[model samples]
Each structure stands twice: as structure tokens, then as C-alpha cells.
Target: MENISAAPETQIKETSFLSLNPSTLEVIGEVANTSREEIDDKIEKAQKAQKRWAARPDAERKEIILKVAEALQQNSKHLAAWITREQGKPLSGPGANFEMQACVGWTQVPASLDVPEEIVFEDETRKDILYRNPIGVVAAIAPWNWPLMIAIWQIIPSLRMGNAVVIKPSEYTTFCTQEMIKVINTVLPEDILQVITGRGEVGSYLTSHPEIGKIMFTGSIATGKKVIEASVKNMARLTLECGGNDAGIILPGFDVSKHIDQLFWAAFLNMGQTCACLKRLYVHENDYEKVVKALTDYSSHIPMGDGADEASILGPIQNKMQYDKILDLILDSEKNGADVLFRGQKPDLEGYFIPVTLIGNVDNGHRIVDEEQFGPVLPIIQYKTLEEAITKANNSENGLGASVWSDDLNEAQKVAAQLQAGTVWINQHGAIHPLVPFGGAKQSGYGVEFGIEGLKAVSLPKVISIKK
Candidate 1:
């Protein structure tokens, strides 16, 4: 453990945060509590840079952003190790390198997108056109889970569309995000893309800053509201990707035994720390026992250990706050009479590790089923009919993502269409891509994150009409 307790920053620092190895509870590094003065300076620089960066031909901007993609691919190995160590996700599997590779794909996709002006009407009598103009100085705030990839999702399109971005990553994963920005800065002008580190107050300052033209955030809904409130100062554009209690429906006659592994990972990947992960599962009454048994068998074979261990598939809960929340939900489920079908074993280690937990026979209103647990624990509820399942899945305040599974593809598609979610999947969950438009419908969020629609969200639209 690197102890900087006596460091100068610690002596004068009003506040600071630590990045720990959740698998061992060891302090991996520390992030300074950046002042409002520092944040304002960075925003000023970004605003000045945005004018020049946006003035360059779109072709020139596209080439430099593509070079960033190549740099991310080249540094995949180093990033993977840092991610695993700082964030406690696996190193080899779907952990560090997997996210890095995905960043490359996400960065490259927007570079190829076309954001051309549209002519609505052209005639001898009149002419009408719509043009997309960049919103200057975007504030990109990313969460700890999927930090690098989500940061790319936020800034890539903004930059490609000609806006400069100031990114504030979660203090827990600042190391990797800082390095990622460093790699990108090699091809970008100074302050065009900058990384700042701090706590919640710092985020509040950035959101309230008048210079920030837009704020793109991904995190809890409570914080989303705060962001919205702060943005009222400047009436800055806001795109919030908030918390989700995503539900997965296992339709009748779907072979639970066949897709059990997919179901397990869909809910448990990244120790269930993902924002769009399936937190609640609804199974047909006919297949409830089979689904439970299949999940139990699948989870028993996987191990939870230190992220550095090659054999470990799942890592710790990433932070103490999340670990404690997962524990509270499990206790509440047990008290509410939900049966524990298979509770994973807790390892004798110092890290924040919780085993894969499946609580069955859970009623609809149980806290475990209602809230976004955001951990390794999942609640499997039973539904007597397709109508009941669809109703329960769409009954949440969150409308981020949902999935319907069945052997019959048509049936799955039909049920998927009725669910009130932004992105509905047939036999899959949380598989977001760069080309598809991903956003929330109701409380989950408002604006999109990918595709042309996403590009437009970061831009201000100007319409022109002329009378002949």
C-alpha cells in the first residue's frame, strides 16, 4: 500500500478521495480535491480551444479522433492492468482489455458518422434548411463502472461534431481515465480534451459553470436531478444516463438450461456494478424452478477472488459504499420471505467480495426487486402470464433497458415492443453498440448517446428559410 498520509496535499487539502483495490481493500492511489478555481481555468481553456477545434475542417477533426482510436488500441495492455488494479474488474476476461478494445470501436464509429446539413424544402418560392452547430465546452461526467468506455461514449461524438470536452471521471477510477485522456491528448490540442479529478462538490461546480455549454452525465438519478438544477444557471444542455432497475423476462418455453450462462453474466458482469445491468429477473411460472437450478449450477463453478488472480471470473463490489448497499438488500430480501436458492460463499479475504446470490419466490414489491441493487445479488420473480410479466417489467420508474427471452423470436419481439424502455432486446440484455441510439424514455434519461440523434443532442440546431 502506498501511504501518502503525510504528503503536502494531504496536509493542506480540505478534502480528497482514495482509489482502492476492492479485492484487497488496499489503497491503490489518491485523487486531489480540485478547487473551483482549477475547474474554471480548465473550462476557460476548453472554451477557447473549442472555437479553433470546431473551425478546423470536419475532415481534420475526424483524422485526429481516429488517431486517438489507434492510440487506445496500442495501449490496451497497460490500460487493462490499471483497470483491474484500480477498479477490481478482471484482467483477462471481460475486464480491462475488453473495455479498451470496446473504446477503440466506440471512438472509431462516430468518426465515420455523417452529420450533414438537411434541406427540408427547396423551391423557386421558398427555401428551408436545418444545420447542426456544435455546443461549446461539454462537461462529460463518467461513473466508476465502465469509466473508460463510457467516457468515450460521451466525448467521441461531442468532439467529432466539433465540441471540446472537459471530463470528470469518478474518483475511484481516475487513474485509468487520466491515462486515457493523456493518450488522446497526444493527437488533440491542449485543453481540447482535459481530465479533472475531485469529489461531488467539484461536479456541482462544473455543472453550474456558465462556460459549459452542455453536460453529459451517467450515474444515479438523485445526482441527475442535481445536475439539472445546476444547469439552470446557464440553461446548459443536459443528457443524463441515470440509474436503472433493468428487468429481464424469461418467457414461457424458453430453455433456461440452454441460456443460463448468458443470463448469469447479463446480471452479474462487473460484479453487477453496471448501470444498465439486469437487476431484476422475471421468469414464467412454468420454468421458475428450472431457471433457479440452472443459475445455481452455473454460479457454483465460478470463483470470486482478487482481480489479479487469473482464475477469478468476478471481482469485488468496487467500493465500500456499494458493498454495504448490496448487503442491506440481501438482508431485506431474507426478511421479506424470499427463499435463498443458492448463496455464494464469501472468501476469507480483506477485500469487498460478495458471492453470487439468487433469491427466489420474491413478491413484486420487495425492496430487492424494486430497487436497483447494483451488485451481485439478483431477485428472480415468478409470473403466471405474459401480460403479468410485461406489466411488472414496465412498472418501474426507470425506463433504461429491458429484455424478453423466448424460443420463439416473434413472441419475444412482440413482448419487447410493449415494454416501456428505451432499448428493448430479444433474448439479450445490456448489449449497447456505438451505431445504435441508446437513451432513456421516462425517468431513466432524456437524450440519446450514440448515432446521428446523439450527435444532434450535443449540437444546437439552426434553421434557415428564404422567400424567393
Candidate 2:
């Protein structure tokens, strides 16, 4: 999801911005800032085209979406390259290549899902049947963190439910989204899917448009509030997935050696930019020392450098604003007496590079612990008891996801039940399956996405009753 950092500069004289490579600060490409009139025109055309598209047989729609997924696979290398350049993720590991593969995989699953009519009640005297119908048009506002994959998350389900979509991707990754849409539109009918590129104003205008029936947004809590206000204008059906300061708890008797690698990637994936990544880690005091040492040793050996380099597993922060914010948070933590267990080497190159860092001797009230840093820094807080750990983990207002680490299945499941987050992981974190429904609790936002529930989110339900 998009960071709570500064919004892209508003378009004034120039109607475009240069997309830059975060690793080298080099220009990748330029994208036009879509105007209000163009957005209106696109929405109107989508409204007209959706009727005919929705009239097509369900099997035909499914076949077409499957073809789109095939097209994405065929073009995976090219698409992965764009993602590496526009967003600062490595080409290997769980980076650009992984994201491209996920895009294809996510698209196919929604196409294969069955949304059938349901018989609610049946009797000799009366009958009731329920149908899933398409909402007129869906507006998808995507974030830069996982631009292509999240767009597919929003678009594929909407199209499967027989609705046209108009997307507004984050300015930081607009061209990358455009490239993915370019591939998708080749297999789709004209006006069935479209992307409008620009700064925040373009997204605000798109969401507030009267013609939009349902809106899907993934971004910051600050911006999510704005989306909720805009939806009030039309009372648009909304599925909002906002920012998360997710926490992970390490049980007292858990073996730190066996799961160290899994735990490392869960937090540092995408340099800890993901909304659902573990932002704060609570370790029982009994296991705190061993856990901290193991994590530091594991993180020190990992490579961090330019994304295009095959040897690098991690890359620079995607933007300068975020890079600076991370530094500020670390500095504050140190000033507040948090111990720096390990800080990775910074390559002798010019870019937004901050290596892997693990902070210890931190507590719940520390700003680094309380706020969503959204970077490669993780603060480990120690707790005296399981109750204390659970209380600390549940203290955050953002409850998108949380994890409990332990070898005891029954004990872990019991701990997971007490967590207030939307989805609790027992032994893993940030591992999302396409078939499961995923959403947040509290201010993290509501409305689930993925699986049959996701298909229903993009469509409307109607009941038909008959007198026998």
C-alpha cells in the first residue's frame, strides 16, 4: 500500500512527472497527469460499455480472463523489469519477479471461482432465490507498494462480476500499472478496463464521481479517511484496505533457530514497506536475548544494493521521503535509548539506501514501537508474561494482521484467538492465499477481499421471492 509520506507533487505547469529508479535516481519513464475532463470521459465510456460486456455469457467472460492471465505469464519478464525499475524491489527472491508471478496467479484464481445462484428457502407454499448481480462500475485506487498485483486484485474480481473498472494508480508507480493494463486490455473488450494516471487530485476526482457505484482502495489511513468522505457523496459500496502497524509475538519456549529465516523475510520483505508486514515484534523476556542475536546474525549476511544487480536481495527505499522518514525514526529510537543490535553495511553508492537494522531495548510507548515506521527497521519489545505480550501486541490501533510464533499448535491457536487483528497467523506472517478472505479490523479498514467473498464484494446481491 501507499506510504503516509508526502503525496506526489500536484501538477501545475507540467502535466506529468518523471518516474525514477530509486536505486540510481535515474529516470525510468514519464507518465501524463490525467485531467478531470479525460477522467469523466473515460467513466462515461465505461458506463456505456459495461452493459454489453455484462450481457456476455459467464463462460465467455471466464475464458477471456484466463486468456489475460496467460498473456501476463508470457510477458512476465518484461513486466518484472518495469516493476524493478519503477519500484525499488530486486529482480529475484520475493521481489519484482515474484510480484509478476503473483499477478498472473491472482488473476487465474478469480476466474476459476464460482459465484452461483443460491436457493435461500424452499417449501410447498413459497420459494426464495438469491442472485449475484454486477454493480455498474468500480473505481480502484491502487498503492505503489504492490501496484500490479493489487490492481489485479481489484480489477480481476470486478470484471469477473461483470463490472467495468477505472483505476487510479499511485503516482510513484503509474507507468508500471499502465504497462500491466496494456497487456490486460489486449484480451479485454474496449472500455471494460482503464487506468487514469496523475497525482492525488486525479484520484480524489475519480472516487467522488457520481457514476462510480463501488470503490476499492488500498492506501494510508489518512487517505482512506478521505476516500470514506468521498464515498458519502454517492454512498458507493466500498472495500477499503488501509495502513497496518501489524505486530508479531514470539512465545517464551519458541525455537528461534528453526524459524529465524521465515521471521526475517516476514518483516523485511519489500524493505518493510508492505502494509501487512510485521511492524513491531514482542518477544517474551525469557527468549528475548536468543531471538535478537539470531535475527541480527541472519540479517547481517543478506545483501542490499541496486535492484537490477542479480546479487542483491534487497534494494533502496522506493522514494526519498520514505528513506528520510526511516532515518528519522531510527535516530529517535536511538536517542530514546533503544539498543541497536545490528545495522547492515551501506554500499558505497549514491541512492536511497538504508541497510537492515534491528533495534532492541525498546518498549511499547516508544514512537518507533507505537507508530507504523514502514521501513526496514524493526523494534523488538520484551514482555514478562504471555498476557503482557498479548496486551502489548493488541495495543495498536491498526489491526490488519498479527502473528504468534511457537511450536505448540494448541497453545499457538489459543493465543491467536485472543488477538484482535483481522487474520492471525500461527507460525507464519504476511503469507496471503488467494482463496482466503483478507481484510482488516478497527481503523485498519473494513470489507474483505479475495475468494468467493471478494467476488461478492464487487457485485450486488438481490432476492426473488415467489408465491407457490
Candidate 3:
């Protein structure tokens, strides 16, 4: 059918800040809000291609994907610039090259994670061998935080395993994702990987569609729960990479003076929008004062402005609701008797900028301490014993990721082991590689992604018996 929605833009202007010239917030780009009918039609077209893509030899499928990866690498500069302008991030930073890395991973499909693993079993007179196969079509609904990188995380492995994909991006940040798809479609077959965009209604339609075999979604926990309920009719296989109120524990022996700089960057990168960003911190009471002082002094010095300015350290909150939520959490924190460690007033302008606010002595009762305030806000809670600390850390419904900091490696390892998070760090944050598996526990949702585990997620395993 070769069906895809024609991009509405006739002019390709630099799509950074779409509103005010001196605006604090970054605009990325404006999508010409699409309709549900158009999206459904696009899904039907992708479904047609998906069936044919499934019939291709696995090697033939990989050959076309390798070309897509090459195109991504070639246009990486263009892609990075687009990410900065459209996503309100720095021109160059830790995550600056992440999208490109995703492109490479998606296109190359590294050997370490390849499956098609053999299986064996025996029961008296019976013998069995195993096989792995694709799950028809895979559905990827991406979030805005890591737009293309997260999309690649889902699409690449799914495609590599011989499953076709229909990608639905967040409406708030769909332009760059759409443009990336356009560039990709320019070089590769459009039927294999198709881009569909709209608000919730369109997403709900495709997600609830009868034809989809499996669904992978990365977003809030609330939405994740809803996705699970919606898929029951089809009994679709699913992976939900939901939100988190991740913890960072500073152990008794870690010298606060020695690692304050490292801690600051970990807590504030991408203005703390990351799922694994240090949303909550538990410090031993003996070292609490020293650590808080260092964080306070260091945080006051970082400049804040728009992401495109090149000099700004923290950009505005990615969207509006996040802006209000950050402020509300701060107020609630203070009301619950926690100490405000920095500027609590949100930027008064229309742009969504909330000052980097760090609070301490926040108990579990407070929303700031308990909830996933996914902004550049850090809350500190003091713990008396290692038992209390681990108990408190694991108290939340979320267990997506957590970190422990200590110069005493043994003590840190002890606590990291006790914490009930999916991914734990010794002294760093947001340290992810393509080979490692990542996901969560409890209300943080379930399943894993990346590396061999991620590749396995894109398919179904089976047992094949051969005559002896």
C-alpha cells in the first residue's frame, strides 16, 4: 500500500524554540496535529508490509537494516542538531550521541545478543530441540525524554528479530521523531518500519487493535497500567518501562568533600528528567550535614537558560504539567517540615523553568519524598542504620533503578545488594550500555530491555523435536 502520512510542513525552519525569541523553554518542533482515521489507515499499511517483511530471509532483513544504520551514522550530525533544537538539550553532552548510538545498535544488531538458541530435553522415550521465532508485528510507543534513542531501543531489536514495527511517538515531541523516520524511509523500505503520530486517541486505537502481536511502551506508570488492561483482549506480549522515584544512598565512609562534583552532575543532568536520575537520596546521619552543604554550594553556581544557548547547564522542563508538578512537590515538601536547600520559586515567565531546588530531612510522608517528582529537584533523607536505609529505599512501589555511593566499596556493595531496584550503581548514575539489561520491580512495571535479554524480548521461544 505504501501509505504514510505526508508531513504537513512545507517549510523546514530551524525548529528549536517555536515561540518567543528569548524564551526559557525550548520548542523542538510543532506537528500538524494528526487525526485518528489517518493514523489507523497508516497502521493498516504497516501491517501489510509487516507480513511481507516477516517472509524475508533473516539475513536479507538484516542487510536492509545495516543500510539504515549507515544512513543514521552519516546523518548523525544532522540528527544530533535536530535533537538539541527539537528536544531542548545541549548541542553536546553525555546523551548528545545517544540517538546515534541507538541508530548504530538498531542497524548493526550486534552478535553478542543474537538468539535462535538451541533447546534440549529428555523424558524417557521422548526428546526435544528448541527454536525461537518472531512475534508477527511489534508495537513501540516512545516517550519524549529520549525520543529517538528510546524508539531505537524498541524498533531496532524488534526489527532485528524479524518483527516489523509501528512507532507512535509522544505528541509533545513528535516532530524530530517524524523527521528521523523520514530520513530513515529515504534510504530503507518504508513498509518494514512505519511512523504513526497523534495524541492519546490514536495511540489507544493502535494499541487496542486486534492485529498487533506484542507491545512495548515506555512512559508513566499510570499509562503503563492502562496499556496492560487494553491488551488483555488480544493477550499481547508486553514490556512496560514505566516511571520511577529512584534512590541514591550515600554510605557512611564516602567522603562528601571528595565526590560532591560527581554527585551534582548525576542529580541534575537533563534537568533531572531521566528515570534513573537521583530523585531521592538517603544519607547516613553522621555525614548528612557535610553532604548537604556541598550540594548546596555547588548547585547555587550552575547557570540556567534555554537548551539552545550552548552555555546553559539546565534547560527548561520539557513540558508544562511538569513545571507545575515540580513546584507543587517543593511546596508540599516544605509543608511537611523538610528544609528547602535552594530556590523554591518557579521561573515567573510563561516558559516552563523551575529553579533547581534541593531539599533535605524529607520524610516518607511527604509527596516530594514519596512521589516521582521527575524534575531537577533532589530530596535528602537521613537514615540511622543500614537496615533502616535499605528498608526506606525499598519502601516505594517503584524500583526501576537506584545507586549507592561510598569510598568503602564493601559497605556500598552491601547496601546496593540490599536495595530492591532493577539496576543499581556503585557510584555513578545513568550509566547504561547496549549490552546491559534494564527495567524495574513492583509498580515500576516489569520485564527487561537491551543486550541479549532485550533481543529475546522481541520474539517467542519454542521447542522442536527431531526423530532420533
lDDT string for model 3 (1-468, tens) is 001122222122222223221234434345543455565566678778777877887777767777788888888878776666556655545544655666676557542345755657877666787666888777788887777888888887887777778888776667778877877787656677877765555566667667788889888888887778767756779988887888888888678777777798778877787777888889989888888888988888776765556666666777666668888888887777888777634434456777788898787778998899888899889999888888888999899889999898887888888889898988887677778888888888788888888888878988877555
Q: Which residue pairs in model 2 clash with each other?
A: none
Worst 10 residues of 1 by lDDT: 1-10
Give the Å shift of residue 1 in candidate 3: 32
Clashing pairs in 3: 28-86, 129-464
Q: Write the per-residue lDDT of candidate 1 for residues 1-468, one digit (tens) a residue.
A: 001111112222456767788888888777887786788788889989999999999998889889999998988888878888888898756777788899999999899888898999999899999999999999988888888899999989999989999998887788888888888888898889977787776677777777889999998877787778878877899898986889999988898777777888889988888878888899988888889889999999888888888888888887888889889989988987889989898878899989999998796789998889999999999989889988999889999999888899988888998999999887778888888999987788789989888889999999899898
**By summed lDDT, which 10 consecutive residues of candidate 2 come out lowest?**
3-12
lDDT of each: 0.85, 0.90, 0.74
2 or 3, greater by TM-score: 2
lDDT of 2 by residue, 1-468 (tens): 432222223232348888888899988888787887788899999998899899999999999999999999999999999888888899978999999999999999999999999999999999999999999899999998888999999999999999999998888888889999999999999999978987777777788788999999998888888888878767899999987999999888899899998899989999998988998999988888899889999998899988899898998888887888899999999999999988999987788899989999999899999989988999999999999989989998899999999999899999999999999998889989999999999989999999999999999999999999
Q: How many Å off is the CA of 274 in candidate 3?
A: 1.0
Find the candidate with the highest lDDT and give its number: 2
Which candidate would rank higher by lDDT, 1 or 3?
1
